[model samples]
Target: MPSSAAHLLSNHYNETRNEYYRQLDTASRNGGDILPFINYAVQGFVDQIRNQIKHIRTEQLRIVWINYVHSRFKTLSSRKDRRRRDLLLHISEFGLLHKNIIGVMALKIYAGKTVTTLKRDIGYLRSEELIEETLTGYFPNLKALTAFLPVQRRVVE
Candidate 1:
């Protein structure tokens, strides 16, 4: 699955290269300028590489976040504790966790658990500095992104 992106990108690059060569051949046969075709292909390559880099960085950030969550909450072994962890993970998917959002998630996931329990779980995550409260609602702390910075720096270098 991971290699799918690389495979698709490789196929795109090959097709682009072939088309560029074909264009160059046609322009040469017609005694026309080839600079535009060269420039266009270069731009496409640059854009594709930039997008791939962005995708890589995003994947790295996700891995770091998941690892951080797993390590920090490793002791949450019991079923109830796991539910709290699940609540944290699920809430992280949303932009914010307000009353309405929490209520909806509670109905879907909490089952026997109460809304207050869900709120308490959120509070616990806040105390752990894993999530932060804002004027709008709660969000996973941006501090977690720090963990990915070193890896990103290495990739950039």
Candidate 2:
């Protein structure tokens, strides 16, 4: 996990633990059966922490994919070239970018460039293995994440 994810998980865990303690104290003072409270708190904490861990994994993957794209496509010197980079980032963030969706995106981001240019950019990304051609459309090749698996394992652990 990255520093931000780790910090957030730590804060959430501490907060949940503190609340569990508070509940336990209240139950003890009131002479109530604390077993139910303990069970509920444990279950809720486990569920919330599991969700947070999944979210952290997703965020980490997105970050790694974006960084890989940036490293591969560093020469964003012209507006046209920059648009290609933007397109790649868009694909990375939101997968299944079909031709029709790309056409709409072209009108917004790749303005002034012809549809041919947009296609060419997509072709270039495919050639570089930065994006993959799926039955639905283009998607960022998350295989790039494998290269950083060691680092990811260390951080997550």
Candidate 3:
């Protein structure tokens, strides 16, 4: 009924993980257990290896999008712990149109950091004030270009 994207992005992944465990539990009852399989065939098991690869590939994409979406929510929310109480609040706050790809790219452009020396001073390059908290995570608050655009004189016919 309402916007489900936020609920989906946050809850869906966790639900999937839960589902996997449930399957494992069922498999345990059916056979012996998955722990034995994991322990014995740690490296050479093709099925396990394939499953891991599949999980990672699917989960990686979800993480990227979900993180960005949550960042947007955090930026907009007026609370300190701005987490979704349920799907309803989430949908009301971040509508479908607001879930934008361009916004995500803008966040990356503003906050992206290089893998440099951890011991090196971070304050030189990073600004704590400019970062915005979204429901998902922290994002660099990128100023809109329109505010800085030069005004153009309109010629009347």
Candidate 4:
């Protein structure tokens, strides 16, 4: 898809998603009175979403999906655990193993810590299978990390 069309589609999708959530909140705030009609209303929103998705090509859809994943990772990295979040941010952006990064220098400076301290965190992440240490450097298991994150699943209609 053309850039203009993709932008337009994204705008439209955001608007529709916001409107759907607003309506859902309004309906649910009525003290359970609107329970019976919630599914019907949601189905309408789902249909609208389906219509929007149906026109996009596979490559465009893949781009949108990746953007969604990246956005989710950004949100996940904003957690209160500063060290872990910083590590996650670094890995997601630079891709430790996959990108053929050198030693701990990249994340070491980012965390403002010495190699020893960073190495501990790296070891922990490796134990958790979020990263792997090789002769080259530490690399991230992006697919595994993404799957492990508690991101909300999309509701398909």
Best candidate (score: lDDT): 2
Candidate No. with top TM-score: 1
Ranking, lDDT, top scorer first: 2, 1, 4, 3
Cα-lDDT of candidate 1 = 0.70
- Per-model C-alpha RMSD: 5.2, 6.1, 21.9, 15.8
Which of 2 and 3 is ahead in TM-score?
A: 2
| Backbone clash tally (model 4) | 1
Model 1 lDDT per residue over 76-96, tens place: 688767776776676666646
Instruction: Compose the digit string of candidate 4's lDDT tens values, residues 68-157.
Output: 445545655433345654675566456554434345456544445566666666676677665666676665555543454455457763
Displacement of the residue 40 alpha carbon in candidate 1, Å: 1.4
What shift in Å separates residue 16 of candidate 1 from its native position after superposition?
A: 11
lDDT of 2 by residue, 37-137 (tens): 76766566556667787787888888887877777668666776677788889877677688675454445686766778888888988997888887778
Clashes per candidate, residues 3 or more apart or on different chains: 0, 2, 8, 1
Model 2 weakest 10-residue run by lDDT: 148-157
- Superposed by TM-score, candidate 1 places the C-alpha of residue 11 at a distance from the truth, in angstroms, of 8.2
Sorted on TM-score, best first, the list reads 1, 2, 4, 3
